[model samples]
Target: MKGRLFLIPVTLGSPDYRYVIPEKVLEIIISLRKFIVEDIRSARRFLRMIDPRFPIDESEFMILNKHTDYKDLDGMMSFLKEGSDTGLMSEAGIPGVADPGSDLVLQAHENGFRVIPLIGPSSIYLALMSSGLNGQNFAFNGYLPIKRADRIREIKNLQTMARRGQSQIFMETPYRNMKLLEDIAATLDNNIYLCIAANITHPDEYITTRTVSDWLKKGFPDIDKKPAIFIIGIKS
Candidate 1:
């Protein structure tokens, strides 16, 4: 029998895995000795966090990132074909969503392999759920451009979409979070609602939704080096 491909979900940043990852998922992760991972060190650290005695040295890890060649994917499935269940893990959150594991999952489906996705914390969904915005009609716009003019234009485009009854969800590199926030406050209308959810699932987590003008009055919070989700809603 061909082994299944388990799509594992790791904690966002919480030290206690149980708080974000399920017990069943932990057990599944422990049982799998072969994995296709985004970052080997991070993946090993996550396994050890789940179980201190996890045989890190004995486990096999295959790297799957933007740099990985598509030709390597076929070889990645060889272990599964030999009846060794393989795991797909991300640096954080679930694999295949805003992560590099999507290609592997699509290849698994094409090869008729069973794919199992485990539940865990997702900053995007968590932000959307917490933000009193239009959840029924929302879009996840992964990240905005880095260029000042381009980024501002994209933010305006998203604002237009939000006005049409859709919520816009986006993110930024931790170091550039404040820059993105500044562009948002500068470009967006005062009445358009914006939500900033930072350090989700971790201590010092902050989530708030306010109009652009209100946010300007309060000034940007110190989320410079924290993982965060930015959401824009048509109506508060």
Candidate 2:
């Protein structure tokens, strides 16, 4: 028998934002005999938030941290051989985008298991849509370097592309937002336009675009440690 797999996207839970998992999707979550999650604890927490009535026994869920050794492609292959349906979910955003669930998807595909990706909220794309940047030509550069020198070099390169009219989107942990903003203010040209989309889809959501010099003068958006997506662009 052929095994089945569902790739579900989950938005990070927040008081300001209540993500709506469709009834059909919730049904899938409830009915699945096994789940392969990026973080087992987080997945359980999300399940509890979604429906307290839904009972998720510990034995029914499998933790698959892609960074750890448990992400053995061979093991996944063996699991699929048993014809068990598996569900993949990340902590936030869509699974297999920046999340570690892509490996399982690839392995499952190689073994000929049917794979399906469910539509859900994506903060990155949402940021791009609202950002007054060149969406026609945009790139998501993922996380920038931690080291100042490396990050500076990377930002300089991205700035050059922005000047040519390519919107550059990147993200950092909530606590690092201030540092990342500081780096942008220091390195980029004062006239260059930058957009910061913070806490998207949440009640306190903020999307603002301003020149580097203006942003410095105004002291950046006061995003209170919320997940954010930052986009830089040279206005066309």
For candidate 1, the clash count comes to 0
- What is the TM-score of each predicted model, taking all chains together? 0.97, 0.90
Reference-based lDDT, each prediction: 0.92, 0.80
Give the per-residue lDDT of model 2 (tens digit) for 1-236.
87688887676555522464556776676666577787878887777766676677643666666465744667766556788777788888678887777788888888789998877778888889888889899999989999989998999999999999999999987888888888888899998989999987777788998989898888887764789998999877
Tens digits of per-residue lDDT for model 1 on 1-236?
89999999999988888999878888988999999999999999999989999999998999999899988999998878999999999989989999879999999999999999988889899999999999999999898898999999999999999999999999999999988987888899999999999999988999999988889898878999999999998673
Clashing residue pairs found in predicted model 1: none
TM-score of 2: 0.90
Q: Considering summed lDDT, which 10 consecutive residues are worst modelled in model 1?
A: 227-236
Question: Could you give me the TM-score of model 1 versus the true structure?
Answer: 0.97
